[model samples]
Target: MKAMTYRGPYKLRVDSKPDPVIEHPNDAIVRVELAAICGSDLHLYHGMMPDTRIGHTFGHEFVGTVVEIGGSVQSLAVGDRVLVPFNIYCGSCFFCARGLYSNCHNVNPNATAIGGIYGYSHSTGGYDGGQAEFVRVPFADVGPTVIPDDITDEDALLLTDAFSTGYFGAQIADIEEGDTAVVFGAGPVGLAAARSCWLMGAGRVIVVDHLDYRLRKAEDFAYAETVNFGQVGDIVRDLKFLTDGLGADVAIDAVGAEADGHVLQHVTSAKLKLQGGSPVALNWAIDSVRKGGTVSVMGAYGPMFSAVKFGDAMNKGLTLRMNQAPVKRQWSRLFDHIRAGYVKPSDLITHRFPLDEIAEAYHVFSAKLDDIIKPVIVPAS
Candidate 1:
């Protein structure tokens, strides 16, 4: 099998590796059909995530056919085409029983916070990801949802992470009807969150970013107002002005560890590893929302201490809600939305790369070249 191997910071290659076999009775071996490079993957790619070992594959958003399965995997079969959730969890755990699969206590024994995440650094779970010809899926019965007959492969891929996360971001924001919602960052997750705000009855939606291309996509795809943080003098103040001086009712920070608003913050957090992640976008979220409003964090951040505006959030009585989205939890609503033609997740695909050229694919996405929003990886391309 050929897998994308991470050598070190910004170094990757397609290496021939041994094929994964079923290691548990409930495990399944999926032959990767389509995979995606997620923005959070950039955290691991840039050496921000701790314990991302060399030779480990880095991909979490993927859909594939089950080529083989263990005997106890009753929910799936060898021939099933499946949409695997990024979360790897035991179905019987306390967290899983409460529908908090992303926080399953039975997985990732070393971590007390997030549960097992496919292809993320060992901090989440050391399990390899699906950025290859095949991947091993643990607790297969609880994780992989068989792709519905009406769904496309690309759409299913998005649900594995990005789209589901976006909807979750909106869900946790608790947007009231006629409320104004602001989403920071214009990446795939942020774009989806902006679009979802309309479905959640937000009166207005605004997306903030520094890139013209992404901001343009936010307008076209999300039907939301766009603001380039670079053009605005003070983003928080500008957001207040847009919302008639009070502030947005809800603010979502979709830009995480690698946020670029503050040069010093970016350098210390992303480059020097002094802080967990840059809190520029998050701080802005805290400062931009109306008093007693909500601030939802959908971005991926390191476990280290960030300079978040906790004092301000407390002073303003803001409701802070966030989590690593349990991808399967959002599927029912997402499937209905996709089938009804509300939003086509595939529209976010700006580029595609073959597994052989995955290194180049990572480079193009990491560099933000070619107006890339999301890039699909074809294992058989």
Candidate 2:
């Protein structure tokens, strides 16, 4: 099997590897038809995430056909086309029973925080991801959902992570009817969150980003207003001004540790690795929302301590909600929205690459070249 292997920071290549076999009774081996390079994958590519070992394959969003299944995997069988959520978990665990699949206690040995995530660093669980011809899915009954015949592969691919997490961001916001919601970052997750805000009855939606291409996509895809943080002197002040001096009702931080804007913060956290992650976007979220508002964080961050604005959030009585999204939890509502033609997850896909060209794909996406928004990987049959 050929897969993208991480060698070091800014280094990746397609290398032949041993095929994965069913290691557990509940496991399933999937022949990956389509996979996606998520925005969060860049964290591993750039050495942002801790314990991302060499030879580790980095991909989480994928849809594939079940080539083989273990005896205990009764929910699916050979030839079943499925979309596997990023999280790997046991359905009967303490957290999983409460619909908190992302925090399942029975999966990762380092289970203090996040549960098992396919292809993320060792901190999240050192499981190989689906950025290859095949992948082994653990607890197959709980995570892999059969893709409906009507759904496109690209759409199902996005649902595995980006779309699901975005909708979860909006879901946690608790947006009231006629409220103004602002999402920071115009990546796929941010775009999805902005669009979902409208479905959640937000009167207005605004997307903030430094890139013109992404901001434009946010405007077109989400039907939301756009703001380039690079153009504004004080983004928080501008957001308050846009909301008529009171600030937005809800502010979301979709840009995590790698956020730009604050030079010192970005340098200390993202560059020097002094802190867990840059809290620029999160701080902006805290300062941009009105008093007694809500701030939802969907961005990926490390387990280390970050210099967050806890004092200001407490002073303003802001509700801060954040977690690795329970992807399967959002599928029922998201499937309905997709079927209703309210949102097309594939529309955000801007680039595609063959499995052989994954290194180039990573370069283009990491460099933000070709106006790339979302890039998909197609493994050879």
Candidate 3:
């Protein structure tokens, strides 16, 4: 089989590799139909993630068909079309029982903490990912959710990660009807976050980003108002203007980095930072929120040590929720949303490339050129 291989920094290639087989009773072999590139994959493309054996297939968001199943896998069977949750988890683990499937202990024993991710890094389970012909899905019964026959693969693909993470971001924010929400960054996850906020009944969805193309898409799909941070001199001030001198009830830093190094002021309430990346977003959130506000971190962060201002957070009485997606908890619900025509996740996909052209797909997506929002790689049928 020809799989996309990561040689090193700024290096990727589609090369022949051995096919995967079911290695555990809870595992299933999925023949990938459509796999999309995510912004987090940029960590691997830039050599930021811990070392994986050469040729690590780096992708997590995908929808596919079950090719084979392990002896114990019963919920899913051959020919069932399903969306694989990006995180691998065992239903029996301590975290799994608590509905914290992303922190499942049994799936990735090698992780420094509790989490099993496909093709993230050696520190993240070291499992081969879906950016290939086939992928081994552990905890198949608990991970993959079946999509209705009427649902297109393109539409269901985003549910694997981006949409799930976005929904989780909104949920953690505890948003209520008529509350205003702001999302920083216009990447796939950010757009998804904005959409989820709209679904949560937010009165105003403000999307912040430098790119006009992405901000435009956010407006089209999420019905979000756009803010060009590059043009706007200050984020907090602009946010205030947008919110009628009051800060947004919920502020999501989906960018994973501080918004231009300007300290966001707590206006009328504590701000929530839904940014994913490193723990640095924590301090940024503390600075941005109004008193007694929430911060939700939906961005990906791995084992890295950093200092946080616990005093500031405690002083403001901030509510902080930071972690990866509990994919299984919302998998069925998200699929139903798709089936009901409530969310058109496939609209987020702007580019498509054949599996053989995956290397170029990475280049275009990582470069963010040509107005690319999300790129999906399809195996030639």
Candidate 4:
């Protein structure tokens, strides 16, 4: 098997590795057909996430065919096509029973902060990801759903993480009808959130980002208004002005540790590792929303301390909701939308590469080159 391995910061390689076998009773070995490189993966690629060991493959969003399954895996069998959510969990756990699968207590013994995530650091339970030709999926009955014949490969793959997380962001925002919602960042999650705001009955949606290409994507793909934070001078003030000086009814932070607006924050967090995460976008989200409005955070951040505006949020009576999205929880509504042709997850995909070119795919995505919003790895199993 050939897998993408991390050597150091800004470095990745495709190397031959031993094939994984079923290690748990409910485990299934899946031959990865379509795997996506998430923004969260970039945290590992740039050495942002701690304990991301060398040679650990980094990918979470994937759809594949089950080549083998353990005896306890009764929900699926060999030859079933499935989309595995990023979360690895036991369905009967305390949190899982409440539809909080992302915080399942039974998985990730090292997790006091988060649950098991495929291809993340030791902090999130170090499970090998689906970036390679094959991956081992534990708790097979709970983690993956059969991909319907109507769901295209790209749609199934996106639903595995990025798209689902974005929908989760919008779901928790609690947008009222005709409310103005503002989204920070124009990445896949941001774009999905912006689009979903409309579906959730938001009267207007605004996507904030510095990149012209991504802003263009937000306008075209999400059909939302765009604002280049770089040119706005004071982005928070501009957002208020756009919403008639009262501020937006809701604001979402989709940019996490690697936000680019503030040089000092970016250098301290993303470069120097002085802070767990840069709170530039989150702080901006707090300031851009109206007092007593909602602020939903879908961005991936480190477990360490971040200088967020907690005092201000309290003073303004803002509702701050954030968590690693319970991906499977959002699937039912999303599937209906997909079937109704209201949402197309496949549209997010922009580039595809073979397992042999995994390193180059990482470089292109990390560098934000070639207008690559979403890149999928097609590992030949």
Candidate 5:
């Protein structure tokens, strides 16, 4: 098998690797069909996450066919098409029982964090990811959702992460049917958040980002009313104006360190040479929300901490909800939307490459080359 491996800071290589097998009775082996590059993958490529072994695969968003399943995996079988959840959760864990699978104790084993994520660091449970020809899916029954024939893999793949994260962001923001929602960042996740907000029946969805291309795409996709931060000097003021002088009912921060509110911490390991987030965008989300509004932070973050204006948040009686998407928890509902054609996330994908060309895919998508938004890697059988 050929897998994308993390080489060094700003480096990646396609290398031959041993094929994976089911290691647990509840596990399954998946032949990856369409694996897409995610913004989170940038963390590993740039060496921002630690504890990722030198040769670990580097992707989490993918759809695949089940090649084999363990005896205990009765819910899934060979030849089943499935969307893999980024979060690995043990079904019997205390958190899983409470529908908080991302915080499953047995799988995550981190006091500070609740979920074990694919292709992340040891702190994230060190699971080998799906950016290769094959991947071993542990706790398969609790993770993957079978995709119906009516939905294409490209449309269903995002149920694994991006769309789910966006839905999670909306959930945390407490976005109600007539509420106005604002999303900071028009990247894939940001756009997804906007789309999800609309799907949730938001009265108005406003997407803010500095990139015109992304904002244009967001508008085309009906994700929201696009706001170009670069063109408008006062982004916060513009958001307020869009919301009729009252801040948005809910504001989601999807721009991590790239925005303003992050404390840049330099951490060194085999992977994740450095990682951080944006305090400015986070503060803007906080400031752009109504007095009784909710703010959801779902973009990727690192060990770096940001100074938060707790006094302001408290004075306004704002609610703050933040976390990586509980991918496992949201998979079912997302698949429902995909199956119903209510959400076609495939429109976000603009580039494709072979497994060996994974590095190039990263370069193109990371640089947003040629207006590329999402790039999917199709490993040859």
Candidate 6:
């Protein structure tokens, strides 16, 4: 099997590796047909996440065919085409029973925070991801969903993570009808969130980012207003001005540790590793929303202390909601939306690469070159 392996910061390559086998009774081995390089994967590529060992494969969004299944995996069988959510969890766990699949207590050593995530760093769970020809899926019954014949492979691939997380971000926002919703970052997740906000009854949606290309996607793909933070003097102030001085009704931080607005914060956190993740976008969310509004965080951040504006959030009576998205929880609604033609997840896929060219794909995505909004990896059979 050929898998994308992480060597060090800014280093990645597709290398031949041993194929994964079923290790647990509930495990299943999937022959990956399509995989995606998520924005969060960049954290590992750039050495932002802790304990991302060398040779670790970094991918979470994928759809594939089941080549082998364990005895206990009764929900699926060989030859089933499935979209595996990023979360790896036991169905009957304390958190899983409450629909908090991302925080399942029975999966990761650090299950106290986030559950097992495919191909994330050791902090989440040291499981190999599907950035290869094959991947072993644990708790297969609870996570992998058969891809409907009506849905395209690329759409199903997006549903595995980016679209699901984006929907979850909007779901947690509790957006009221006619409320103005503002999303930070214009990556796939942000674009999805912005699009989902409209479905959730938001009167207006605005996407904020520093890149013209992504901001353009936000406008075209999500039908939302765009703001380039780099062009503005103060992003929070600009957001407030756009919202007519009171500020937006809701603000979401889709940009996590690698946010670029604050120089000192980005340097200390992203460059120097002094903090968990740069909280610039989160802090901006706090400042950009109106008093008593909601701030939802869907961005991926390391498990270290970040200098967040807790005091200000408390003072303003803001509702701060954040978590690793329970991906499966959003599937039902997303499926309906996709079927209704309200959103096309595949439209955001801007590039595709063969597994052999994964390094170049990573470079293009990490460098933000070629207008690559989302890049998919196709493993040769």
Candidate 2, superposed: residue stretches over 4 Å from native: 259-276, 303-306
Better of 5 and 6 by TM-score: 6
Q: Write the per-residue lDDT of candidate 4 for residues 59-151, one digit (tens) a residue.
A: 888999999999889999899999999999999977899988899998999866578999987778989998998999999998999988987
Model 4 bad stretches (over 4 Å)? 259-276, 303-306
Task: Put down candidate 6 lDDT per residue, 1-381, tens digits, no spaces.
Answer: 999999998889889999999898989999999999998888778777779899999899999999999988899989999999999989897889999998889889964788899999788789999999999999998899999899999999999999989999999999999999999988999999999999999999999987888889998999999988778888889999999999999998888876322222321222343454667788999999999999999987764366789899999999999999988888888889999999999999999999999999998988789999999999997
Whole-structure CA lDDT of model 5: 0.79
**Number of backbone clashes in candidate 3:** 7
TM-score of each model, paired residue for residue: 0.96, 0.96, 0.90, 0.96, 0.92, 0.95
What TM-score number comes out for model 1?
A: 0.96
Tens digits of per-residue lDDT for model 3 on 205-275? 88877778888999998889998766867666777776676467777756553221122211101233432
TM-score (C-alpha) between model 6 and the true structure = 0.95
Candidate 5: list runs displaced more than 4 Å: 259-275
What does candidate 1's lDDT look like per residue over 309-328, in tens digits? 89999999999999999989
Error of 3 at 49 (Å): 0.7
lDDT of each: 0.89, 0.89, 0.77, 0.87, 0.79, 0.89
Residue-wise C-alpha lDDT for candidate 2, range 1-381, written one tens digit per residue? 999899998899999999999999999999999999998898888777779999999899999999999988899989999999999989998889998899999899975777999999788889999999999999999999999888889899989999989999998999999999999888999999999999999999999988889989998999999998778888889999999999999998888876322222321222443454667788999999999999999987765366789999999999999999999888878888889999999999999999999999988987789999999999998
Worst 10 residues of 5 by lDDT: 260-269
